[model samples]
Target: MNSSSDSDFFDVIVCGSGPAGLSASLAAVQSGARTLLLERLPGLGTKLLASGGGRCNFSNLLPEPEFMAAFGRNGRFMTDALRTGGLVFIRSFLRSEGIETVAEDGFHCFPSTGRAASIRDAFLHAAQKRGLTVKTSARADEIRIREGAVEGVRTAIGAFSCRKFILATGGTAMPALGGTSKGLLLAEAVGHRITPPLPAMAPIPVDDPWVSELAGVSLPDARLSFTAGRLRGSCRGELLFTHEGLSGPAALSLSGPAGRAWTEHRDSFRLILEPEAETDRKIWCERIDDARKKEPDKLFRSVPGRTMPRSLAARLAALAGLEDRRNRELKNADRDRAASLFAGIPLTVSRLSPMEKAMAMSGGVVLTEVNPKTMESRLVKGLFFAGEVLDLTGPCGGYNIQFAIASGRLAGENHTGTLPLEKQG
Candidate 1:
């Protein structure tokens, strides 16, 4: 932070103050480039401040291959970005800035102080020391271009000229955090094709009222699966029933893929929730039989009730039409129905969490339009993009933030390093 008023020009300008923009500014300044960072919000990193319930799970420590896989098919787009500022670099960068990080669960990394401010402050401190100018409450509305190259950016305050610019404004997942389409619109106006964004990492708002009835109940280890059109994904973890629909890790992680599929086949979209995910149908049948033998007169609800929350078990039993029957009274058809229900309960998905309620989103700038190698626009010189603006999305557990920081650093470093061939010519 150059806390003083803005200058008319700089070597680089970063639009957005989220993790990616912060990293870009810091990297540019660290490389001796006169840099300016503009943020639309009054404060920086609003979404970041709310991340991980404010603990800010910032990175993951998995090996590169597995790490990339977490981001799905387009995960490989982050190869160069991650290589430039991966887990090791981030940990070292934080440590050098007097902030230490720890993977509290031996996976997701967070600041030792357990505050998002720690990471944001570290970047601010480091970047300011290197002369990075700051402007908040300033939104970049247009990118001035000349001969297919970025010249400067126009903001509400004023126009700032820059040889290089980085766009890391993120997606429209949370409007309260100032998430908007301005960034995407800015890129689109400059020739980059944007993939329509979809709300993700949020609960699925099902139309089924029975799930709402089981609100406050959770299956600690359940598998959520969805298959519709081009969408196919599954995750096993906690599945929580909410007043509106489903929440918890399993649902959140599956929400992205599920949303994509559901949006396409809204009327036919169906999900399967496996309460006994680890136990196959055969095993479930055996358990039900054991319950039948040991408690012949027990209500059939006690079958699944033994392994899961009684309320949910009772609901599933009711769904399977055995709630009022006893164990000994179950016909073979009832047995098969109960076992199948326990194995994989069919759930019709009516809608996904809206953008305003989402924690993250899937889809962004089409990956093909930008070079992950340098985070530069393939169609426009001196214009770089990073973070959630890209098409790649990962599961929960800090994957999103990790990519943001890494991609930002890579974009910053390369954007300010060498002049483009067109410029040189």
Candidate 2:
């Protein structure tokens, strides 16, 4: 509700200054468009600075097919944008900004400097160098739509007009970094269909107090399976015990489906941690047999050290009622019990962590409402969306950033071509 008399217009206006917004602004400016980048926070890329434990994992080097697979079912929607603006382009862009990248395990890429701030500064520098006008502490109050086309955005300061608007306002994650549902609300007011937002890439809440007692214990090479009543799926990697529940790669990957399942079937939702190698019960049985003969003095719980964390091993053993007994003291039934415990350590998942604790959100503008090729809104002319705001969230790692930058670039480059706003009437 601010005055607009002194507001300046631009060829392109981008809301939010996260990875997607900055990337879009950069692309727009590079394309010879007068661009304005608006952010609600006092500084830009607040969330980016906190990613990858303070070292921004920019993108992954995997092929498009492999990269897309990480996104699950919504992966295909990103094929077009990624094909045009994929990891290759992102790597090249970062290099151009003098922020070199190095590929780590699983083809995950991070800044050579190992500092997320470096990547953030690089984006800000690029945007400034390209003459993109950036306005911080400028939250968009509304998207001014006239005749079914975007006229401009109304901010706290005033109304700023633009030929095209890019809503890269991000999803409702990391609220401390300025994420809110306002972006979805703005889109909805303009006739865009929004997918109900839910927490994704978040930690699962376990009610067991023993989990908190084991906080800081991390298990690598473990597989986590999430089961909601009859539905079940599994992810294999690492898990870290937190005071509230479980976190880390495997736990985060299963959070989305687990959260959804928990909502529908609150009575029963479980997280099963199995030794990565013993995913096959036969293999576990053989290992149990070997342990019984070779290391009879070793506790049954100690057997999991070959597969899970020492802490997890002890917990599993205790769960199977074999923590006190030595491996040699185990009867044949005890061996079966130990194997069962090692194969799947079930933790009752109570619920999802709050949105503020979520790494990313699952829902946003439905994909069908936007053109996958250009990221332009089919319902609202001259308006486009990218990043977590688009109901296209992928698993944790570098996939989310890749999707954000790819979609941003695509929307920026295709903005003008998709802006036949006069027909919106």
Candidate 3:
């Protein structure tokens, strides 16, 4: 490894060439800055290729308020960025690069070709045409700062100087795709505080024995709520019973809150699972009574399946102490108990799945330390942050990628000095 002098210096250096760094580098070069993109991996977008099971859920088309709300408290910080056409800008940028997108369920967006490689290749082609220098397999060792301002970065390849720098190394999730604590370490070195990172979009473990019995059973439109005293977190989507616990969209989205609750007090965490439309326990009881009248010989275990999976129905019947009886043998009290179980089946949450299995993580460089408008560090001039490296985590359904692209776009577009926008076809 050899150090580079002034001749090789760049106007801006973007670290990590995932979605965020790619967007940042493109924005910087398009702004007429001599930009350099540094990636530790041999290839870019490694984790990205696995998103949406390879279909690549690039972004969502949700309206601004609804989309931002998915991020919880930090969502407010993205107001100016999203309002400035962040999501739209990314989509438009892709379209300009000849990559088309299709919307799923009128909200989730994916590449028209259903390939993550298309987006990755588009970025590489654009960077090359704009003369952006990308160094793959070059790990950034340290961020150099001079008297509270950006100086340059020390990488495994060599030390290089830059007028500005952006850290988009991402959070410590999906370790197989290069996720690590390197970003957190770099931020700490630069006088930034990082919140304790936890698994966000990840599966959750439960203490119930039925979890294993019902493994592979999936419930669509199930509502899961976790409560720790007064603090509560909830999400409604598909839920899956796993050998160890619960999974699928709803459980994964709710893991962040549940993980925090468990940390507050392990035994305080409790999860309630029910059909999304479950509201009145009495109504369920009445439905059961009607079923008993319609067919007195019907099996009690088969009753709950009308609202949930047959396996779940059996479990609920057993929980309510009515599984051994037929509908005709059930007394009014037994009917009520069975109905109540269906309304809200309580499950003890053991903990969240390990971070390695999570899609994204909660916690990173604290949001307050960066200027949300430009993603530039408020404490360190000429230094910026973006993507999962920041203290922002969103629910499943393309929100994370949207934030990465938006934050990176803002950082690169607003980089200081005179510049010219690269002409596009």
Question: Which candidate's lDDT is highest?
Answer: 1
Question: lDDT score of model 2?
Answer: 0.81
Say which prediction, candidate 2 or candidate 3, comes out ahead on TM-score.
Answer: 3
Off by over 4 Å in 2: 1-5, 104-106, 229-232, 277-279, 295-298, 305-310, 415-425
Give per-model CA RMSD. Answer: 2.3, 3.2, 3.5
Q: Write the per-residue lDDT of candidate 3 for residues 1-425, one digit (tens) a residue.
A: 12344336787889988788887888788788888888898888787878888887878878888888878856988886665436678778789988889995898899898998887778778876998888887888899898988888999888878768999999899899788999899999989999988998998888889877999999888899878877888899899888988899998888887787778877676788876445568888788888899878888887776777787788888898887788899988888777777788888766678878888988899988899878889899889987999988888898888888777777877544555423211
Question: Which window of 10 residues has the lowest lDDT sum in candidate 3?
Answer: 416-425
**Each candidate: what lDDT?**
0.86, 0.81, 0.82
Q: What's the TM-score of each model vs. the native?
A: 0.96, 0.90, 0.94
Alpha-carbon runs more than 4 Å astray in model 3: 1-7, 276-279, 418-425
Comparing 1 and 2 on lDDT, the stronger one: 1
Q: For residues 1-425, could you state the per-residue lDDT of candidate 2 as single tens digits?
A: 12224367777889988888978888788787777888888888888888888998878777788788777667889988897678888778889988788886757789999998887778778877978788888899899887888888999767888768999999998798777999999999888888788888998889888788889988776788877788776777888888998888888987876777778777877677775634566676788788889998987776766766778678777877888888788888877776776677677765578998898998899899899988988887779898889987777778888888889888877445543223121
lDDT for each residue of candidate 1 in 272-364, tens digit (9 for 90 to 100):
889767977899888878877899999998888788888988888899988899998988788887888788888877667889988887988
- Any residue pairs clashing in model 2, and if so which? none
Residue 54 of model 2: what lDDT?
90
